[model samples]
Target: MERVAQTGSTNADLLARLAGGEHVGEGHWLVADRQTAGRGRLGRGWNDGQGNFMGSTVVHLTAGDPSPATLALVAGVALAKAVTAMAPGLDARLKWPNDLLVDGAKCAGILMERTGNAVVIGIGVNLVAAPELPDRPTAALAAKGAVLDRDRFAEALAIAMVDILWTWRQEGVDSIVRAWLPQGHPVGTPLRVSEQGIDGSFDGLAPDGALRLRRADGEVMLIHAGDVELRRPVEGN
Candidate 1:
């Protein structure tokens, strides 16, 4: 665990270190108080709230490891567990891939990058304050009355990751998927796939963790990648 007052982007910094032949061990985390160049999935800017949790961790992959992409699920389950543990009954849930939500509002997100034999997973949480997102509603632990200490949350997250990661590697992706299903948005929830320009209902996740989207035609599509959003009912509908 390492804490820095400021940095451009913890994920970028850690990736650079790894590319420069530095050994970034698993379980080691690089957390920044403020990330000037923080980013979310699809190159979106990640808002840097002062008291939020912004950090990156590396996972070294070896032969026989499950798909690297499934790490997103591992990270999601770990994050959801950590937050729910700290603030019990907070209604924390995970949106597919790796977005954390509380009562249908996003509160945190995860980004993963692969290089050589390692994957760097970056995460940001709205702990004390939530950023104003143009497309989605946001929430914060403190605003919701959780009032967590940033440092304490970081420690809890790290511990949770260790346990979940082990399960992912030892018990297989199926185990992670089972643990994740109950923590995620309930099946049959309406959703829209931004990339595919299609709408569907959440059917659940595939065995390997790909999203299972049940289309209007009653056909189930296995979406390997896409920007998924909860399809909210329009007013006056």
Candidate 2:
């Protein structure tokens, strides 16, 4: 694997270069010490400083392709595995879609961009503790005792991701779901999920991957996709 490490924004620059006809292929990555215009899920902005693991990998898919959701899961799973391997005693878990959490704190987040038959996976992990966001309960890796070497971690992640991707491709979604279950957060407990317009509330993670929450009128609603904020049980809170 090869890496292009720079001092500035990686995601923005990669997209720019890619638009300019630079054909980046698999096994190559565009890494940045700081992403001035870093992005996150749900169109949130990230203010990544130096001393963080912020980068993106370019993965090329075959011309005829399936949905890219599996790749996203594989990337998250591979990253969780690598982080656990790098830091023993780190009980890393996967928050569905693409977040790696250790001891209930976020250690990594992945963003995938698809163009035609290729996908560029952008991963941002905080090696050092990040500043607090009053609006959410998100977290960083250093808060979970995971301070890693960027280059080494990136290499391990890429290789492991390739393996995970291969397995998911061969065995299909069931295999991926089975592997994801053990690491999943406990079910039947209230999970704080984003409400359509107002603040979200506690619910449980459904078996088929939707977030199950009771509405104001005692109706149970299944959320397809949105950010989730795992909260402590009312007694615990």
TM-score per model over all chains:
0.98, 0.80
Question: How many steric clashes between backbone atoms does each model show?
Answer: 0, 2
For candidate 1, list the clashing residue pairs, or say none: none
- RMSD values for the candidates in order, in angstroms, are 0.8, 3.5
lDDT of each: 0.94, 0.67
* Best prediction by lDDT: 1
lDDT string for model 1 (128-185, tens) is 8888989999998787889999999999999999999999989999999999999999
Candidate 2 clash pair list? 190-203, 191-203
Over 1-237, each residue of candidate 2 has an lDDT whose tens digit, in order, gives 444445455666666667788998766777776666788887766658567778777767764443565666667777777777788777777776677776776667888777666677888887775646666455666666667787787777778777777766677655666666666565543456554442334354444445466656667777766676665555653
